[model samples]
Target: MDPHRLLIFREVARTESIAAAARRLGWTQPAVSQHLRRLERQAGLPLVVRHSRGIRLTEAGATLLRHADAIATRLHAAEDDMAALADLAAGTVRLAAFPSACATLVPTAMTNLARHRPGLEIRMTQCEPPAATTLVTSGEADLAVLFSHDSRLPDHGPDLQLIPLTDDPVRLVVPTGHPAATAAAPLTCLASTPWIAGCPSCATHLAHTCEAAGFSPDVQHSTDDYVVVQNLVARGLGVALLPQLALDAYHHPDVRALPLATTERALYLLCHREALQIPAVAETVRALQQAATAHRPQTPPAT
Candidate 1:
């Protein structure tokens, strides 16, 4: 199949109208329609059904659309590869990261990169780990800063590589006068206390840890924002488990952070294996490591 024709068909399939696809591609509608016709002839099947509303893909079109999307992703990666050969000062590096990492590590890395390579273009997207990983793997971003509560991360597939960035110790965050607002929280101290949780993955890890400590947390509220989590805790809504970076990013005066022995979020940089060949991406990675190292927290001893 012709790759160019596949791309045109993919665009039309996405927009559901040849004219809309043409507008986006800067081509005439008849030209796009002709390409689709030729593509269908090559496939030997009716690829689309047209009606007053728009277009609908036939079964064969749906199947081929998946391949077309993959081809498009590969083409984008090829573009990045060619761009990597250019001067480092003129290259671009894209990064995706979760909110906490964005708040702490990313800014530092970005600043350092800008200082060292003034002409380099750095782009960033704020997303959770799952979305961040997908962005890097799909060639949408060159590198991703993501976290896993699990020390052992799952296999993210063969196309990707991971580098451990730093360890962010988890802490017990409680209202000022809460019973466990001390240096070391045995966790059992808050067994019957109402709990506030963060993202789903963090909540799952919190639940498992609580169970291991001989009780299940009575989670009463949830929020993904670290600032919100600390603010809620300060208002005495419920206590929470938070990573050190959350406190480092923004801490509420009315809440206290106590040590949670053995619990920590493992931070990592994820990227396509080929991404590191680009000078801009490599420099970004090095800067990220330095930032992570500088901000690394000292895990409080278990009391």
Candidate 2:
């Protein structure tokens, strides 16, 4: 397949509309359709089905789109490398991080970068770990700040390296003046108490922590927002297990926090091995490591 046509096909597949892709690429609708036709003819099969509203990819098209996306990723990485050669200070670092990390770690990292590498541009995206991983893998982001529960180890292929930043301890939050508030390391004390869970992974981590204390928690509410979780806990509706970073971002006055008995979530900076060769990306990584260390309580500095 023509490399250019493959990129066009990838864009069309992403937009799910030939006209939309045409608008984006500044080409006429018919011109984009003609290229799709040529690409399909070269493949010996129809890659997409025409529709009144938009196009739908056939199985063959879906298969080919994956290859096209891979090609696009490679092209983007090549562009980043060439840009790196032109000027380290002028290069851009695209960073994707989860919400809490954005709230706690990113600001400090960006501030340090601005002071030291004034000309380097840092673009930030808010995403959970999985989506952040996708951004780094596809070359949409130069690096990602992500976390994993103690029960889960991240393996994002050999091409990418996950640099350990800090161990974010999970804390149990209870309503102020609640019975569990005065209990020392009250994780077991709350096993029978109603609970508010955070994201799915956090909920799972909470469950495992409670299980280690010999009883399962009775979860009654769920929310992705740590603020919401804290408010729910403050209302005496349910207690919650939250990462230390979330509390660092915003702690509700009516909630009492205590460390979980045994669970510690790890924060990591994920990136392609080759990406570190670029000075801007490397500096951003260093700054992130420093930020994570500063934010973490009693954490040792990264090597």
lDDT of model 1 at position 242: 89
- What is the total number of backbone clashes in candidate 2? 0
Give the range where candidate 1 is weakest over 10 consecutive residues by summed lDDT.
Answer: 177-186
Off by over 4 Å in 1: 1-87, 183-185, 299-303
The segments of candidate 2 whose C-alpha lies over 4 angstroms from its true place after superposition are: 1-87, 299-303
lDDT of 1 at 77: 87
Question: Taking the tens digit of each residue's C-alpha lDDT, what string does model 2 give over 179-251?
Answer: 7666765776776789888777888887887888899889888898999998988888998888888888998
| Pairs with steric clashes in candidate 1 | none
Residue-level lDDT tens digits of model 1 in 268-301: 9998888888777888899999999999865472
TM-score for each model: 0.70, 0.69
Q: What is the C-alpha lDDT of each candidate?
A: 0.86, 0.86
